[model samples]
Target: MDEFSFCDKSLSYEVRVKDLIDRMTLDEKAGQIGDTALGVPRIGLPKYEWWSEALHGVSDVGQAGNHVTHFDDVIPGATSFPTVILTSATFNQSLWKKIGQAVSTEARAMYNLGHAGLTFWSPNINVVRDPRWGRALETPGEDPFVAGRYAVNYVRGLQDVEGSTEDDEVADLDSRPLKVSACCKHYAAYDVDNWLGVDRYHFDAIVTEQDMMETFQRPFEMCVKEGDVSSVMCSYNKINGIPACADPRLLKDTIRGEWNLRGYIVSDCDSIDVMLDAQKWLNDEPYYCLDLDCGYYYPNYANTSVRMGKVKEAELDSALKNLYNVLMRLGFFDGSPKYEKLGKSDICSHENIELATEAARQGIVLLKNANQTLPLKSNKIKTIAVVGPHANATSAMIGNYAGVPCRFTSPIDGFSKYGKVKYETGCGEVFCKNESLIFPAVRAAKKADATVLVVGLDLTVEAESLDRTDLLLPGYQQQLIQQVSSQSKGPVILVIMSAGGVDISFAKDDPNIQSIIWAGYPGEEGGHAIADIVFGKANPGGRLPLTWFYTNYTDMLPLTSMRLRPIESLDYPGRTYKFYDGPTVYPFGFGLSYTNFTYKLVSSTKTVNVKLNKFQHCRDLNYTEGSYKPPCPAILIEDLKSSCGDYKVKLEIEVKNVGERDGSDVVMVYWSPPQGIAEAPIVDLVGFERVFVGGGGGSVKVGFELDVCKSLGLVDFRGYRLLPSGGGKFVIGDGVLSLPLQINFRR
Candidate 1:
C-alpha cells in the first residue's frame, strides 16, 4: 500500500478527489453510481446509499427506500412538517427556510445514526403547471418565478453553513458541519401525471423552444444559479423527442455547457434504464457516449458494461468528476471532526418541533370565511363537534412523503383544545363509506353548539402513482356534511385536510356551510395550528398557491394537453393562472385573512432609449451600400428591444391594514404587456413580496427594483427577451393598487 495525501484535510477538494479516484479500480467506479455503493475497504471508504429522502423530515426505508417513504409510519415521530404544497401556500420564503433548516438538521441526525444519507432528495421545485398532477402536492404551484424564489431560499436554508451566509441561518441544520444538500428535481418540464393513455414515466413532451426557454426551464435555471443546488435529477419524461436523462442539450449543453452548473445529474429512479429500453437510444450519439459512472447507474448493477467501446473514459471521468466534487465539498473524504459525534436526542429537538408548528400555522389556507364565520370566539361558542373520517385519523392528517409524526394531532384533538368538544369518525374508508357511522356523526353534529367537519382525500386516494378520476370528495363525507349542516343550530366550519384543490361546489352554494379551510395535510403540530386559527389565537394568513377550478373545466380540459400559453379559440382552456381566463372557485393568490389590506402605488420608473431615434441615427451614420455596413451596433438584432440588457425598473408601494384585525398580505405584482406586444401569457407574475401589516392602525412602505432587461422580459419565438419599451402597467395588491411604469433607456 502507498501513502496518499487524499487523507489530508489541508488539500483542495479537487486534489483530494483526483487522488481518491485514481486509487479506485474501474469496477469500483462503475459500482459507485447506484444508490448503494460497495466500499473499497483498502481505501477506508464505508458502504453507503444515495437513495435517502428528507422531503419534510428524514424518511428511512431499510433497503427499498422510496417504497415506504410516502406513508405515515409512526406516532410521536420525527416532528413531521407540513407537505411541500402546504409550505408553498404560505408564500413566506422565510418560513420555508426555517422549515428547511429543521429538516436538514434532522437529516444530519439521521445520517449520524446511520439511518440516512447526507445528500437529501428534497425541495421539489418543479413548477406546478397542471393542478391535476397527482404529485402537485410535491411541488410549488403554477408560476416558475415563485417556485424559483422558494427554491433559492429553501435551498440556502437546507445547505447552510453556520456562518457562511447570514440570510440562510435561522433554525438548526447543524452546529457547524455543512447541512444536507437539497436537490431541485425533475430537471426539465415535468408537471403532469398519468393521462391520455400515457403516463409521465414515458411521456414524450412536445414543447416549443420559446415556451421551453421562457416558461418551464426558468425555475431549474434559477435553482442552479440562485440556489447553487448540489444535485439535479432528470425527469422521467422526454423534453422534446429524447428522454431527459439522455438529452445532451439539457444535461451537457444547457446545464453543463451554458450554465456551467457544477452539480451532478442523477436519473430519476431507473430513468436511465428506460432510455436504453423504451427510447432505444443505446446506439445514439449522446446516449452512446453517456458516462455510466455519473450516477447514470443501471438498475441491474451491471458494472461489466464499462468495458464496452460505445463511450469514452474521458467522458465518464468528466461526469464522475462532477459527483466527486459535490462529495468532496461536503467533506466526506476529509473526515472532518465536526461530523464524528451524534445522538438520538437530535432527531426532534424542541426547536425543531417549534419550527414544525410554525410551518403548519403559516401553511393553513383559509379558503372561505363568509360573514366572519371563523375565529370562533371561546365565550360565544360553548360546544364544538369535530366529525369526519379525518377527525381522528393520523394517516389522513399527514399526507404522502411525510415523516413519522412526533405527535399526531387529529382534528378531534385540535377542536377539543377549547373544551366542550365532541368527536366522531363520519366514515370508514376514505374513498368509500360505512353506512352505520353517518347517523351517529350527524347526531353528534346536531347536538353540539357548532360543528367542525374535517374531511378530504388522503394518500390512498391520491399519491405517488395514484390518480383521481375527478376532483370531488372521495366518500359520503360530503353527504354527511350537508346533513349535519342542515341539522346543526349554529355555524358549520368545513375543514379540508388535503393537498391539491378539491371541487366543493356543494359547500360553496350551501349557505348553511359558513366557512372553508384548506388545512393541507399540516404536520404533527397541525392539530394545534388548526386549533389556533379556529379559536382566534392565530390569524390565518395563508393564500392559495394553486387555483381551484370548477368541475366543468375538468371535463373540458384534458390532462394530456401540454400547451402552456393560452389558445382562446376553444374558450382557452389553458393551463395555470397565467394563461387561463375562465372561472375559478378561488383564484391564484387568493386567501381570506382575519383582516384586510389596501395598497397604494407611490412611484415607478423604467429604462428607455434617451437618445432620440438612436437606432435610425446609428444606422444613418454607419450607412454603406444598400444596408448599413454591418448593421448599427446599438441596434442589436432585427429588434432593438432585444439589445437593452441594461433596462431597469423601480417602484415603491404603501400597504396598510385596512381591515379590523392585524395580518399579513402578499404584495403580488402582476404584469400585462402592451396589447399586440407578442405571444405570451396574459397578466403573468412579475414580482411578489409577503408584506406584514398591523391591524386597525398599522401601515408599512415596501420598495422593489429590478432590471427590466433580465428580470422582466418576453421571449419571442426565437428565444430573445423583448425588453419593455412602451409603457406598461404593474398591477399591485392583486387589484388594490395600480401604477404606471415610465421608461427611458440609457443606451
Candidate 2:
C-alpha cells in the first residue's frame, strides 16, 4: 500500500482520494457510508469516526469514542464554555472566534490522546425561530444575519489553516490543511425537537420559499460559501414535504451547486431509520427485500441500495471523495500528525479556562437597573442573601452539549467573596412546587442587608424533546420570588438563568426588585460572572439575542406556524425582531450597562447608485421624483450583482461614554426597507460592533462598510432579493440615532 500513488503526500487531495477509491471493492466502498467508517486494513487506512460533537467544547455526547475522560495521569476534563445562545448575546464576533479556536485546540489535543475524532460536528447555525423550541440553547438567535456571521467566524476559528487568508478564498481553502474539520449543522429549517404531539422525526416543516431562503437557509449558505466548512449534517425533519437528507434540491442543488460547499453531507444520527419507520418514505418490494422483515443493520442499507440501482456506485465514489478530502486536510493519511505530542497540558490549560470565565462575564445581560440598584457597595452591604434554586447549582450552570469542567463556582461561592452570604433553596428546586420551603428562604432574605434571588428554568423544564408550553416561570417560582422580595430587608436583585426567554413581567414591574440579570445558562464560571456584575467587578453589556415575549405571544401563535410575515386576516403577529411589531417584555438588542453611551454619526454616504445595463427595467425610471411620479419599480438585486463594482455604503459613528463607570457597549445598526414596501420587516440588523469605553467622557469611532446588494436588499415573496427605489432609515443603538439613505439605478 505504501507503493500506491494514493499514499504520496505531494499529490492533490482530489487525486489521492480518487486513487484510493479506485482500489476499493464495492462492499469496501459501501462500508464507508455510516458514521463509523470501516476502513480497508489492506490499504493501511484506519477506521474513522464522524459523530463527535464540539458545540461549545469537546463534549462526550457523540457515539464515537471521541470524548473527554478522566484517568490516573491524564487530564480529567475540557474547558466548557457558555452555550451558543448566551455567547451570541455578547455581539462580539472576535470573542466567538476565539472560543472556537480554544475548543479546537483542546479537540486536537484529545485526538492526539486517541480520545477524539478529526471532524467535529458543531456550532449549530440553526436560527432560533421559536423560543419554545427545545434546542434554542444550541442556536445563535432569530436573525439570519447574526447566525450567518456566527457560522463564518466560529467555523473559521475551528478549521483555521496556519497561513490561510482572513477572507477564506476558495482557492486558498482548497489548497490548505485544516487544524480540525468543523461542521455547521442540522442544515435547513430545523428548530422544533418535540412540541405538543409533534416530534422532530415525524414533523414536516411546511416552510414558504421566502422564509426558507430569507431566514432558514441563509446561515447554512454562509457557513458553506464564507466559512468553507468541511461537513454539513442534514436535519431529521422534512422540509416542504421532503426529508432533508433525501432532498436533492437542498443537499445537491442549493448547498453544493449554488453555494459551492467543499464538504460532505451527513445524516442527523439514525435518520435513515427515521426515514424508513417514522416517515415511511420507502415502502416497496425492493426495500422489503433488503432484510427489513428480519433484523438488518441500517448502515448496510446503503450497500443494498447500490446493488438495487437505487443509488449509483459513481455517486458513492463522489461522496467518498468529499469525505476523504476532509480526512486528508486533517493529515489523517500523512503518516503522523505534527502535533502528536499535544496531550494533557493542552486539554484544559489555564488560558482556556480563563476564556470561559471571560465569556460568561461578557454575555451576562443586565436587564434592569432601576434607580442605580446594582453594584451593591461592598462596604455598606455587609451581609448578603443568595436564595433560589440555582444559588448553589453546579451542573445546571453548564448547558447541554457539554463536557466535564476543570472547576465550578456556585452563586453562593461567588457572592461569599464579596461579603457574608446566607444561602437557601427558595422552593426546593426551580419548579418551586413546595410552598413549605419558601418560609425558610424568606427568613434568610429578611436578615441579610441585600438579597440576590437566583431563579429560572433549567434542562428539566426546557431541553431536547421538551418544548415549553408557556413563557411564564415554572410552578410556584413566581410566588416564591414575590414573597421573598416582599420580605427582604434590603433591595432585591433578580438573576435568571435559562436558555429561552421568560415573561417575568411581574418582577420587572415590582419596585422592590431593584435589578434584574439574564444569565442564559452561563458556563462553569457562571457564578463568578454573575457576582462580578452584581458587585461592579464587571460591567454588563450583553444584549438580548432573542426577544423576550409576553405570555400572549404563545397564546396567539402556535409553535408550528413557520411564518415570518404577519397575517392580518388571521390576526397573526409574525415572529422575530425582524417582522414582529407586537408588544414584548423586552425587545431584541435590549440591555442595560453600569455606564451609558451615546452615538453620533461622524460620516456616511447619502445615496448609492447601481449602474445598470440597457436591458434593465428600472434604469429609465426617475428615482428622485416625489409623490407626483409613479414609484420606481423594484429591481432584483441578483441581476445587478455584476454591475455592483465598488458600490457600498460606508459609515463612521462616534460612541461617547456618558456615565462615570467604564463599560462595554454594543453598537447595533439596523436597516429598514422603503416606507411603502409591502410585507417588509420593521428593521433588519445589518452591522454591529462591541466596544469598550473608559469612564468620564471617553469616546471612540466605529466604522462599517456594507455592500449595497448584500446588506440593503430585502427578500420578496417569490424569494427574490429586491432593492426598492425609495427612502429608508439606518437606526443605530435602539433608535437613539438615525440616518436617511437611498438606492437608485443608473443606465
Candidate 3:
C-alpha cells in the first residue's frame, strides 16, 4: 500500500470510480468518450498523457527535466499577461492573481520536468466576435465583463489555489501538486466570421435569448461561477445545430447542472470528431448549387459514413468520467505528484533571458505619442536610422506559441550596437522575401537624425495557420512608411511588429509620424526591447491587445452579415466596442503612456447594495456627482466584502496620476445588462484597476460585485448555461476607456 496502494486494481480513481461504474462495457464507455488515445501500458495505472497546450508556455512532449524557457521554437514563454484583452484592462484581482501565480509557476515548472499534467487549454474565454478572427489572437476582448475578469484570473492561475502565494510564501495549494489543468474554452458560442476554417464544422450559430443571455453566456458564467473552473473545452463552432463537443445541453445542463462544475469536460482539438462528424452527412450547398439540371446532392461526407454506435452509453460515461476526473485531481495515476519537479533549466539563463526581456517590456503598445516623438533623448538624438521589414528580423519578435529563442536582437541589431546607427531592409521580408528593401530604406531615412520605422506582420503575413487576407502593410510596407516619412529630418518613429491587429490607419493618421509603437510580438528580447524604447531607457507602457481594424479583410468582414447573423449578432452592443459602430481603426482598450492620468467620473448605477462585512475599502463608495454629467462616470460601491459574512453590490473608483513622470492606469469598470435581459455594451466591463501615478499625484480605490456580474447561459441551442441579469455599466478613460483625462502636469 505504499504509493497509494498501486492503483488498487480495477483501474483506480479510488477503486475505479464506483467499481468501474458497475463493470463498464458500453463499448468501453463509448470508447472513453471518443476523442481518444491510450498507449502507455508499460506498467499500469499512471500513464495518460493526452497531448497538451497551455496556449503560452507549457506544451509538453514526454517531459524533460524542468528547463522551460524556449520562445524561439515558437510560443513557450509564460507570464507576459495582458492579452485576453490586455489582461482585461487590468481589472486587477491582484493582477489576475499574479498572472495565476505566474501560470502556476511555469506550469509547475512544466510538471517538475518530466511533463504531462498542466493541461492548459487556456484563457481563451472566447468573445472577440470578429476583428477578423484568426483566433482573435486567442481571445479575451469584445467584453463580457472583460471576458469574465480574464476568466477568474486565468482559473486562479492554472489551478494551484488552495491558499496560494509565492514570493510571500504560504502556498499549500493542496500540499503542492497541480502545475497545470486549467481548460475553459469555446464550449459555447465560439465565434469567428471568415477566411473560412469551414465554420468549425458546417456552421450553425443562431443565438438569441437576449443574445444568448447577454453575449454568449458571459464568459461561461465567469468560468464556472467565479473561476472554480477545471476544464470545459468543446468548440469548433455549431451552437444552433448543436456540436460544441456533443452538447448534452452543454456538457450536462449548464456546465454540470447550473455551475456546480467540479471540473473535467474536454473536447476541443478535433472537437469529438467535430461531434461525430456533424451528425452524419451532406449539409448541401456545394457552393450554392453548381446545378446539374435541378437535383442537388452529394452525400457521403466521409468518416465511414458515420454512425459509430450513434453516441450514448451515458454520453460516453459522462465524457469519460469527466476526463477521468481531471486525471484524478492531477495526481495523474500517482508518480509522486506534488508538482513532481519545477522550473527546469538546460541553460538559457540570465534568468531565462530576463524573462524574455520582461516579456518584451510588458507587451509594448503605446499607439501614438504625438509631438514628443518619443523617449529618444540619448544626448539629443544623433543619426539613427533602423528602418523596417521588421528591422533586423529573426522571425519578427517570436509571436505565436514561440519558445527556444535566445539570440534575436535586431532593429538592425538593436540600433547598430548603440550609436550613430543605420540599417535598411525597410520592408523587404514581407512574409518571406521581397528584398528591394524599400530603396535602401528610403536611403537610410534620408540621412537620418531621428527615425525608427521597423514595420510588421510576419508570421508569414499573420499567424495561427495564416488567415489575415487584409489589414494591409506588406512588401511595400505602407509605401515604405510613406517613403521614410518623406525623408525625415527628425521625429519619424513607427515600430509596429505583429501577430494580430495591423492596419495602422496609415501610420495612425501620419503627420510624418511622430510615433506609433505596437510591439505585440516582442519576444526574443524583442530587438533589445525595441532598443529600450528607442534609447530613453524604457517607459512606453504598452496597450492595445487587439482591435485596430479600418476596412481590411473585405472592408471589415460581411460574410453575408456574418453567416446571416445571430449568435445574438455577436453580443455586447454587438461585438467589439459594443457592436462595431464603424470608424474604429484603434479601440479595444487602446494603450499608450509616456506619462499622464485623470478619470474623476464615478457612479452610474444599475445595481449596488453592499455590506459583505463593511465592504472592503475602495473609497467606501456611496456616490454624489449628479449635477448634469453623463459623459460616462461611475463608482457606485454599495457593500461588498464577503468571506461569507454577506453584504454585496459594489463598484468603486479613484485613479488620479496627473503626470509629469511616473505612469500606468487601467481602471475600467463596465456593467450594463438589464434591458430585456442581456443585449449589453452601453457598459460591459465590470471592474478593472491598475495604478502607479507619481510625479506629485496618485490615487487607487477599486471594487466590484453583484455576484460578480452573472450570465452563464445557453448550454443547449448548443449548450452550457447561467442566466441572471441587471449587471453592467462602467468606464475609466484617460488613457483608454475612451481616452480623455489628460492628467495635467506642472509639478
Error in Å for residue 120 of model 1 = 0.7
Better of 2 and 3 by TM-score: 2
Every candidate's CA RMSD: 5.4, 3.3, 24.3
Model 3: lDDT to the true structure: 0.54
Ten-residue segment with the worst summed lDDT in candidate 1? 628-637
Best by TM-score: 2
Candidate rank order under lDDT: 2, 1, 3
What is residue 93's positional error in candidate 3, in angstroms? 36
Model 3 RMSD in angstroms? 24.3
Q: Which run of 10 residues does model 3 get worst, by summed lDDT?
A: 287-296
Kindly indicate the candidate among 1 and 2 with the higher lDDT.
2
- Would you estimate the TM-scores of all the predictions? 0.90, 0.95, 0.33
> Ranking under TM-score, best-scoring first?
2, 1, 3
Q: List clash counts for every candidate, in order.
A: 6, 0, 57
* Candidate 3, residue 611: how far the Cα is off, in Å: 77
User: Which has the greatest lDDT?
Assistant: 2
lDDT per residue, candidate 2, 537-656, as tens digits?
Answer: 999999999999998888887788888888778888889999888889999999999988989999998987766676666522223334333245567777777765578899999999
Measured with C-alpha atoms, the lDDT of residue 360 in candidate 3 is 60
